[model samples]
Target: MRATPDNGLKIRAQLEREGINVPSLSERTPSANSKSDRKKVIMGAVIFVLENAADALKFVPIPNPDAIPNLLLKWLKVYDTVGGNDDGLKELGNDIRKAYATVLQPLELSEQIPPEVVRLIGGFHSDLEEQINEIELLKSQHLAKRTILAADITKRISGVRTCINNALNSVSTQATILTLLREIEASSQLTLERLPRAAAEHTYVKSKSACRPSTRVKIQKSLLNHLKEAKNRFVWLRGSPEIGKTAISRSIASTLEKEGTLAASFFWDKSRTGVGLDSLEWFPSTLARQLAIFNGDFKASLVKRLRRPDSELILNLLPEEQMKTLVIEPMNRLRGIFSASTQRFGIILDGLDECGDPDALKSLMNLVLLLDGLPSAFVILTWIRLHQTRLLTQSG
Candidate 1:
């Protein structure tokens, strides 16, 4: 039966009792020939039933309540417009509607339904519509047999009931799976928050200086090309003191930041001595924090690593170990997700020679070399004074 204004008002009142406010159907005129207006009435009725008849329709568990109206409207549109008053099509539509209502009536209450169930229901409706169309075509060609068509209609209605029952049966299993996923996400978020980080080491610090607009153009271009096309991950830029390596590093970081590919940057300054800037103690954790911020997939993998039972000792490990634990492992997990077309992520380490601890500087170089075996898309740029040239030579 077509939904009338009085029926809509009753449905609205019922929904109001359930703490929902739906606009009255009287707000829009209903015309069966007008597709838009007819669909609106169907949508309004479906939404009203879902909101008002929560207890009665508890069998249909819609996890996302907002999605049901559109889904149900799609099924209903098969019978939405009945043209030329074909008696067989009209009777078939009535039988399908009755069968649908009957199927929903006997289902047990549930709290969730998977997308597979929804697709199954949609498939049943499509198959039923196709059968009806085939029968119509046969009738037009004067080849239709009434008994055969009746048997097909009965079988189609049985299939609809079976589809609904199957969907209801699978709800409990799907709900369990969904609950487990949510718990894992919550746990991951907590572990990631517990990861230690240093904020001051970021390249955007006020004391940091980038190259002048007109200067270092050639160096910046070469550095960018190396980042994009070079197979080797580590690029050591060794130069004499006061040659503006830090400035060039900062400028490269800025350019990468604008392009959304800068993973992290750390600059060691001897002038900022007492603030722990000369040590590599916080370096790995700082980069881990920034890498987590850069990409969600990396963050998830890092959180998984941090959730391990022995992960608390990650910060206490040697700098190279810390780099492997926090950076390399998580980046390796992203190999399956990245493609050749994906932009390379830039990492800048400036002035490691200024680090006062020789042991820490040695460990940093080891860590840099270790990073060379990482994904080809990860670019590691290290800047050091000419005096530290022997460290790279010795390590090689």
Candidate 2:
């Protein structure tokens, strides 16, 4: 290329071609070939496009036609129109495309429009966040319910653990729980029982087994015979309070209880501070526990009855019923099982006058004697009432 002055001021570029057919300063036909040169420039651009872009269409199948850039396809079509007639233009087209892409990249926008326009992407994002918030709220509510249920389950587990620990301790503690279970079994034989009176609290009970054998000789002999003889099955004594009656009875009971021949006994004391003598309610049950403990064979029957599903209801039975159910019946059962050889028994019930109603005690006793259909079981009565005396006289 060379620069030349035109009309002394304009600068013009002139081709300096060697061995190429083009007009120059020395050539007189420059204007004559200018139209043909324009055709050559257009044809060169077509060949360059075909060389760079043609193979991209052939080697890579467009998996989604819609994914192709429309501008790229339009440009490819223009290149094919101009260069399709000449295969020599293919390489040049590919080289031009490399340069074309380098220049085009900086002009492209950041993103395409389809997801924003066709898919409602903004709504989808909002819905996702809303769903996440709802799930978090639900989790918080369920956590509270789970905590309450967990606490309840833990409480139940703790109760079971305590019960199991108590059982394990029983093995090392002399089977105290089993003894208590036996006591509970015996307790069922009684109904609304007045607490038992301690023997030491009784005035006539001087801790001796009998009234200084020298003091109550005749009384001792008679009471012993009554107890020893299982034939009579009933012995009624008539006496007054503080007249050596209770002394004899307690002496006899204390001695017999030790010998294991005493079935059951109730020493009445109105001053005893309970319903023990009130209608003799506690009489039967007190005797029952003693009898059940005395005879192992009888425990099975007593425990079986006491352990009934509704065994607590039995505690509400009348005193006479309690005596019949707990004492007389069990004694009779022993006699039945052991036959006539069943051991004779005695119950010392002294100080009847101290009862809330001595007549009630008398009536309940009379009921026992009247209903006396069992082996010999003697009762010693000591009271300070004339009415009871007449009642006893008639009943005895």
Candidate 3:
């Protein structure tokens, strides 16, 4: 039963009369003894049957539901005969069969196929048909041309898979970045909420007063000079009541703040009788909170500390322990970022003598010594009574 051009044309005409439109096969008939031509004929038959099976599913009643599975089995037999030696073609065939079985065949059997499902199947079928036509055309060409076309098709399939993988990875990376940003934001908000502060203690409080211009110039100049050139970290501004020590401290704070080196300031007024401004209970946490607001790097380091399991214990610790944990630890973490800089941060404590507790005042004097050993340069200025100032200067 050798195929001939006249036989192909007669078969096409008969099918056309039956209202079927198969591809013309007159120019594709195989030679009687050519194995390659025989393989081409088998491939064409497989493609034709697959197309008929796909078309049969389009009808509402589906001409013969049982026959469609039989057509698929026959398609696999023909595919194995021609494509078993070509791994790429064999894999493509398996994928097509799986898609049909998994998504279309079951839906068709249920008699509830949606229009979108039909469109999906139609698009998939068209793409497979185009690839099969290309393979058939390549098979008819010279061996070199067939090899080139086969390699090109393999490359295209691999590239499509790679693109899909890259898109998925990009979406995952974006989601990770967004999650990290949200966590950082939440941590920052919590840090601000947990720390206690006295709003009236800041140097910018409207009720506080700075030194009058041209007054106390000699003492102010000497203090500023010592801050700039002295190796000691602590400076004591000592005077009796009504001698303007508080005013001079306020003036120094304003100057350092304007120079962008003021880390924090706290003013204690004994006149605010019932207020806790005369105690050290909220002192360390308040300064730490202000430092966090002053610098971005310090804020990030402080947030890391707040995430620790023991962080909640910081607030309950004594003033000295709180100072070390809340303030010194975060400043130590900034060593790498601050090492190259010579700029000194100024921390002002106005009216330290006004603190009502003797034990707390002594503890604070010891804490000032601890600030001297910190990694970053810091200048601490305190205003106290002349009698109390001698104890710290003598200890230093």
Candidate 4:
């Protein structure tokens, strides 16, 4: 076994054996805050160790000096006696290289090494370089996968939301309100915005003039209760022509509008002017116009048809399918759009008795039932009670 030296000499010998070209231990350690003095001592010791070892061993240091530096680091880590000293190790490495170069002639260590050594060192460098490239590629691929997955998940969630909203909109009248309430649960943003102000306004009008507050409250309460449960009931208000039937229907329509409700009202009359139900073709056109007003995209397309020089011709030329497409589809679409736009809307018909065509009344009712799929509508008929038998006798 080699004799161990004092701390200074032991460090020098270890550096030489481990191929660590640095100064002795004392020179490597700094007196508190004396970094320059510490650096000089460590550097001087490394130079001496490398030169002495080279002369004694009869071998030139390798051209690739990093091998010695790496070996020194491994030795320090493995040796429990070595303490924390990264700077010292680095200084040692630098000094080793410098000393070998300085005593070039004295050491007789200028011969180039064999191909096997060069290949061994070059192989390690190539492996490290390849590993770095692989790591960079893996990082890029992981980021790309994460971004794509996030986008796909977001799109699916949005699609579900849209489907839910569309279904809620298609619900007619009070069903519209109820469905919205369900979807939103505790949030009032959607429900409040959609509730029809017209419905509330009509209620206000009916209640404002009553002399007794209790009576007004009772009537308002009754109306709300009726409205809440009247979704599937067929309603008929039979009275004289000038009685409150039309007024009530108007009130209902106004109420539904205010609540942002979806509703359609048809008025039948004795007059055969183009305005009455006699001009059936205009019915779908009028309904489509209403739908277009509520839905912006349909407005421009519908307007194009309305403004055509052959507009009347086009309207007449509309096939039953086309008529259904324009009028019936819009009325059906109103179930959703009206509900979305307002809370409740339904069909309100007044003056059915005045139409003098009982068949028209029955036909209109059938159409309402067929198109709306629910009886949430309000139909007010003004007719002499005495004439009810004639109106009711029709096969329509």
Candidate 5:
């Protein structure tokens, strides 16, 4: 009831004027241009309505002054889906609070009202203050829940992929493309950045929306809790192709990232040929690079370990040695530093089925599972390879 057809037309017209055409009404989240001006106008209308109502109802008996500002935001949000006018709205809230204080300015209340009425107002104020604090806590929890819920709903509706091969649209290997790929295949001391670039140039799964939160909600929750138990040191998710294994893994990584627990991510694939499969050989070194960036001692130890005369040479160190020295030793020190239950470390391996080399995978699996004896560390393996199940059980 707050927004009219004319208001909708005005918003659509402004979007068209700015060449910000949203395809459907369902896609209500605003584009960048429409986010500000369009929301500003709607908020302005809401403020105007609140002002008019305040003036007319001034003489009528009212519940409380607090309701007035809350009403303003409630009515404003009825139209603006995205918080485009967040800063302006915050300023307005402050202004309304100041105006309310001015009117209630601790003046000669005894002269105008009975002592009982004054005491009642004071009690109401205290109750309102308590309610405000409670609302703040609830608001935060509710927002997080709603965010996860909305993203899950949107992805389910649209069938958005958890990950996609963007190799076709990747940055051009324009000059000597053949040479570049061959170099990658031959290279042993590659950095973490090239790993992602080489591994099929896939979508980075930047945000939580890269996951379907609802479908995986139960599993994700179970996994986190399971990590606390002894049996969850190695958690494996097996699923058929296109069955959302990658999506769930991405979601798990996203969750761990938020919790400051994600140590590293190495997503594999068959699409990028040399680069993707090449990742298998240097996976430990890549993870070491990632962890070193975050943990200083790990960096120092890693540098020392890799600084030997052999490092600058052909880089022919065995995979297990790389895992034990480059990864496990540093991670051991890290575990000592962050021994609290709240502090956790996690590694994610996705698309394990796509690894062309079985021996390389066996090495990686053995390396990953070495964390079993360590506290507050977990390894997540996702993908389907029925034949490899026996190998995995044997490794565990």
Candidate 6:
């Protein structure tokens, strides 16, 4: 309970002297005629308290209206001095004592509801008070509900948000699966568009592994035949340091690709001076990247898939059949722009002698060749004439 402005303080002091909790309000207060009667008694005692303060200041010099602020301070000083056990103050105290009995008369003498209940009942009072204040405005003006068009627009916005969430989730799931697929095998390469979210495509490239054929004519002819026979193939070209096998293979691949007959090609250029021996997965990845330039969604999807660490691609490299089952199967299942066109997929693997591990190279080439069911696949293996030339020649 708090003291009311000025008058209530004096009433409170008087009530306290009588061992009555004056400033506190609770359900225990006795009622007189009604609750209103009890409030009137309290207010009356408060007014009488103000009268006591007026009498206490009778001896103080009155100041001009202009000096009221200073005069009020002086009046308070005198009141404080006379506050403790003064006869006049006690008389003033008696006045409230007499008033308390009357003030408390309106409180009914029955079992009381706890004070906590009273506080809880007031929980919504602030909001009710604000609404009551706005009653005048509500009476003067009509309030309107949300318009039908506004409601419909809100519903549509919510629906669109849900749809966007669903789309993102699906794309994320696809990316996770594709990346896992990339880790497990290297038979086919996943290509993403070079835009935002570049992990949608699994990032795996076929190892450039092949035994080079002896002649450029044979390389060209073998590549052509592989293109007709398989969709994914590895062809290696072998020759001495200055041999023009790479140039010839590139010319053939580029021309065929332009004619929409070849899906991809990797020609290792000795003069160009970089990592050579491109084939299988690497070739198709380049092709897919180039193709993705025209498709933004494809680029974003590929990027998203490439970023996933748990991609299947990392796991598919164990056995040849596993590589086929995981990598090649998924590649064959891809329904994209590349498959929509009738172009054949070709890989030109150049420079077998330049590769560090020839046996591993041979295994990779063999795996690509053994990937069955892709009729339009082809690989052209290029290498320098060496001790391994007989081996390649015998295999051919």
Name the best candidate (by lDDT): 1
Q: Across residues 1-396, which tens digit of lDDT does each residue of candidate 1 receive?
A: 221344435545755887876554335453644755544554555544543333454346543332332333333343333222233332333332333333333232445545755564455445545545554553444344554444554444344334434443444355567679889878777887675665534454556577898887998999989888757577778788778888888888888888988888887777775655667777777778788878888888898898789998787787888889988888898786765646788888887876667767877787778777567778888886777778888877
Per-model TM-score versus the true fold: 0.54, 0.44, 0.52, 0.33, 0.45, 0.32
- With candidate 5 superimposed using the best TM-score fit, by how many Å does residue 317's alpha carbon deviate from the native? 1.3
The per-residue C-alpha lDDT of model 5 at residue 205 equals 37
**Candidates arranged by lDDT, highest first:** 1, 3, 5, 2, 4, 6
How many angstroms is residue 17 displaced in model 2 relative to the true structure, after the best TM-score fit?
99
- Candidate 4 per-residue lDDT, tens place, 67-133, comes to 3333322332221121224353443344333323332222245366444434443444344344334
RMSD of 4: 28.7
- Distance from true location, Cα of 138 in model 2, Å: 84
* Shift of residue 113 alpha carbon in model 5, Å: 56
Cα RMSD for candidate 5? 22.8
Q: Is candidate 1 or candidate 5 better by TM-score?
A: 1
Q: Looking at candidate 5, what is the lDDT of residue 129?
A: 45
lDDT of 3: 0.62
Cα lDDT, all candidates: 0.63, 0.46, 0.62, 0.41, 0.50, 0.39
* Residue pairs in clash, model 2: 48-93, 51-90, 51-93, 51-94, 52-93, 52-94, 233-376
lDDT of 3 by residue, 122-196 (tens): 444344344445545544566676456545656433432233233334334544665687797876978666878
Q: How many collisions per candidate? A: 0, 7, 0, 25, 0, 70
Cα lDDT tens digits, model 2, 1-396, are 111123101101211122222222223354435644433443444333333334342333222212122223333343333322222222323322332232222113223323322233233223334433433343345556555433343333233223223322323243355467668755754532332423322334433344676887877877777667756655556654456777777777767777767655666666646545544666566666666656776666666665567556665887667667665665666665656455666655666665566567566656556436545444333333545756666767
lDDT of 6 by residue, 1-396 (tens): 111234335546655796755432222345634545444444444444434443433332322211211222232233342222232222333333332222221111214423332232233223223333332233334343223323333333233223323333433454466567657433223323221121111111223222244445675675566556543344444556555654555556555656655433334322322332332223334433543343344444444455466444632445455444433444454446445645555544444443335665565445445544333332333444656656555445
Candidate 2: residue 188 Cα off by (Å)? 9.4
Off by over 4 Å in 3: 1-183, 204-207, 273-276, 393-396
Candidate 1 versus the native: TM-score?
A: 0.54
